[model samples]
Target: MSSTATAAPAKKRGSGLFQGLQKVGRSLQLPIAVLPAAGILLRLGQPDVFGPKGLGWDKVASVFATAGGAVFDNLPMLFCIGVAIGFAKKADGSTALAALVGFLVYSNVLKAFPVTDAVVNTTANKGVDVAATYNNPGVLGGIIMGLLAAVLWQKYHRTKLVDWLGFFNGRRLVPIIMAFVGTVMGVFFGLIWEPIGEGISNFGEWMTGLGAAGAGLFGLINRALIPVGMHQFVNTVSWFQLGDFKDATGAVVHGDLNRFFAGDPTAGQFMSGFFPIMMFGLPAAAIAIAHAARPERRKAVMGMMVSLALTSFVTGVTEPIEFSFMFIAPVLYAIHAVLTALSMAITWALGVHAGFTFSAGFIDYALNWNLATKPWLIIPIGLVFAAIYYTLFRFAITKFNLTTPGREPEEEIEDITKA
Candidate 1:
């Protein structure tokens, strides 16, 4: 075969892999969509918000807090089901059911193992034996099980079986296969996950130890990961496992978001910087895109860009605007990533600590104000970043003739929504 033919196949394979990753990334949005409501309810239930002096409804606050906490507590299962349904060929009920079965079996099997903190220290004097929950894999495990369930369902949902097994040959086979596979996975993880888990835990600690520099690196990597959808994995570590705090009830909480909500003064280091990027920087970039459009196309571009800008400002959902220019102007994306790193470092140095349940949007910034340290600083910082983003983006777009929104030729114009 000609080298050109071989190159074509390689290109197709690369495209297929990229598409697969994008699918996984998109799948994560399903579960993440629930966090904002949970965060709102949880915050509303806080003493500073709706408790004693405010609504004077302590019991109601407790109920709201518990209701919201339930979602965070069950994130692993949610991710499992969400990913399964998202990746399944049909997004049907059966795929979700299979994912649940797989996760339950995998988790319970790990629980069955009598693992201790140390191999030789089983006595209470050295270290007490751990509970079944010790084997819990958190959301990462859920994502794995979900992907497995999706794959199994996609491949075996319509497989034929022997005559006696005909009744279970179709959709029913999925859960059955998952149960067996889950058992195997449970045993496999039980044997191997200790070191893996420790490595992740240690990495999280190292990142925390790095302070401002670490936060800066995380910001840069987080933005770069957006295109491939792997940002959520890093987010899981940063938001769910980077720190530890004990709540009023003495229960331990982990991750920046959880610890912040649980009243840890030291939390939110990983989250504070995004406020400027999402709420101001990206919106300004949208403005630059709008300003660079062809004169005749500016009106239509503004209508679309305005919505994207407002979405970023209010909700901190920057994908609409980021995606608009990222592919067409990758250099701009790179610049955005570097600016994010700078923002993280600057925010950390300024002692501006803020937390969010959903994202670094206005809603979260305002909602968590009472719990934040120097929360007012975010506004000034955001404005400065906004100016920087607008100046840089406008200059870059003009110089490069980048195809952002309305700059494309009439025949080649594509929908921003689709991007």
Candidate 2:
């Protein structure tokens, strides 16, 4: 008559973390994927390419330019959509709409008064302007607004209000609250715009001033931060968060080093360094993976590798490929990190000035080329990097017996599946 001990119920895995990660991945997918196509269009529309009597392909070029230009120009809208869906509990339409409301409020409030005009009229010569708040509704800003809307929706979506406002309570209340909240944020942004912008610009200059070594550091850190999704924070500090430098007349000017590279293209310096790594290095790495695979698996691996490589090279969507080998061959991953650092250093040394709205892919290269000071050099530089990547990866795989692709044991694969 001994009492049998009941085994504790198997602990259920938290679906929240997984679901959240999926949403973020999904949110980023479309925007990141679309960048390369945009880059190509931008390249086609360059004055040299599409100008009058320049090329017979003007019509074809125009189409690419229009499509890419649309995405590049409306980054804020894209961010809003991405953030809303990424943060929503159910990925519903209401969340997306709420995000739009937040964006609209922030935009309108910021636009109502131009900062420069206000500064001129004010007694304080150094006072910040209001227009700066609306100037660049970047990815970070979109995320913030989206999160605000999501939180509001989650908290009040089911709450009942007084009879007079009952109809407007719950789901309908989200947009209303979102707009009001955005307006409040607009006021705060307007007040601090100048100081925030200046601080960010100074930081960008400091990083840029470090030259090749700085680029290497940036590359290593960027990759390290990818797994947790906090790379966005670094992005904001380097790109969108920084304020634009200005000339003596107070007109916005490019930072010295950045101007020397891409001129006044997009927003940041760190983004430019990625062009070499993404367009050339990653694809080469993919080739090495295919080459290292067993003969029987080569065709299948090649197909997958080609698709993933194309996406990385063309658009800068690298997660699928990076994740492939990251878990299986961490030593190889470390090598990849070092190689990435070297690529950034090399690009900096060459004075190549390509930048990207997305990843360092061909599409971004194409889009940003015209805007870049020496866009033609990007391809040549990237090609060189590609060669280096191939040699290094191939050698490392064979010499070290790195478990890259075909090296994984059947039992290990089975265990991974079971887990």
- Give the top-scoring candidate (TM-score): 1
lDDT for each candidate structure: 0.86, 0.67
Going through the candidates in order, what is the number of backbone clashes in each? 0, 6
The all-Cα superposition gives candidate 1 an RMSD in Å to the true structure of 4.5
- The best candidate in terms of lDDT: 1
Span of ten consecutive residues with least summed lDDT in model 1: 128-137
Per-residue C-alpha lDDT of model 1 across residues 1-419, encoded as one tens digit per residue: 66655433346657887888788877887887888998888888988767986788999899988988898778888889998988777869989999999999998888766454434446654664433235546778888899999999999998999999899998899999999999998998888887887786788788878888988999999999988788976887688766667788666677888788888888878999999999999999999899999998999999999999999999888888989988989989999999999999899889988999888999899988998999999989999999999999999999988888888877665554356
Error of 1 at 10 (Å): 5.3
Give the per-residue lDDT of model 2 (tens digit) for 223-317.
77666665654554454444355433344533322232223533334655677778778888899988998776688889999998999988788
**TM-score for each prediction?**
0.87, 0.74
**Error at 400, model 1, angstroms:** 3.6
